[model samples]
Target: MARNSYTIGIVLIGVAIILLLGKLGVIHFIASFFWPLVLLIPGLLFHMLFFNRTLPSGVLVPGGILTTYALMFFYCNLFGWGAMSYLWPGFILGVAIGLYELHLFDRNTHRGVWIAAMILGAISVVFFVITLLFKLGVYVIALVLVLAGAALIFRRPRSW
Candidate 1:
């Protein structure tokens, strides 16, 4: 009877706390901002399981993908969704990351997987560079022009 009462008390207390936090909007706030933990938690769990020898290397594929996507989502949530325009390459990078992890961990993985990973990684990098260049090209051109003009003006004549 005592054990039963103790368990009931604990359950009631937990319920009360949960209700209070929900009423205070804490639950809403956490759910809104930290939803990526849903993805990250499972991704990390998959990794932990594989590392602990509870699962196989194949789990790492989804683990890597989910972890990368969760991180990308968190970044967007913290900064702004507008940044997604520049970060679109991260989607391809996530797939590449997963493939690379599979290739690294799975001894039986085919060479095609590695080649695909490399191709995807290269594509992601190229897209990232192109986006960055498009965004910062004007500033780069301006800086180069200023530097060239300054160098021309400051050059010293050779002594004859």
Candidate 2:
């Protein structure tokens, strides 16, 4: 239809202008500040493709990984690189989450693999949280007290 063609043409021209502006540094916000979008776009594209069935479910692994890592990098950029030491495990956990998602979506998935992925993802998070807490100077004594309290609350005493 003529109307649809006109709309498409207008969109193309808009894209051309934006690209030109980016090239000319007239859109410094895109070139400098929104760089994380580079990672985010493809990561989201991967998921969209998977959901649309354009790509196999296996793609979820990389998609989740890229998206999570991009998020982590964005977070680090906002805070500081020093947090990376504590947050490094999150990278692996992100992939694990993706793998888990793949397993959930794929009927032919091997349960063992997905179970391992979930376990690994959990380990990554737990390890990082403990590390972060320690780095923040949560005392060993405090941890011991908390653990002892939890044990007392959860475990019933045996009758003699």
| Winner by lDDT | 1
Clash count of each predicted structure: 0, 0
Number of colliding residue pairs in model 2: 0
lDDT, residue 33, model 1: 93
Per-residue alpha-carbon lDDT of candidate 1 for residues 1-160, written as tens digits (9 for 90 to 100):
9999999999999999999999999999999899999999988999899989999998988899899999999999999999998999999998899899999988799999999999999999999999988988899889999999989777957564
Model 1: weakest 10-residue lDDT segment is 151-160
Candidate 1 to truth, TM: 0.83
Once superposed on the true structure, which residue ranges of model 1 sit more than 4 Å away at CA? 1-10, 150-160
Error of 1 at 9 (Å): 5.0
RMSD of every candidate to native, in Å, equals 2.6, 7.6
- What is candidate 2's lDDT per residue for 36-152, written digit by digit as tens? 778888889999998998999888888888898889888887897898989989877887878887888887988886887889888898888788777875587687889999998
lDDT: worst 10-residue window of model 2: 29-38
- Best-fitting candidate, scored by TM-score: 1
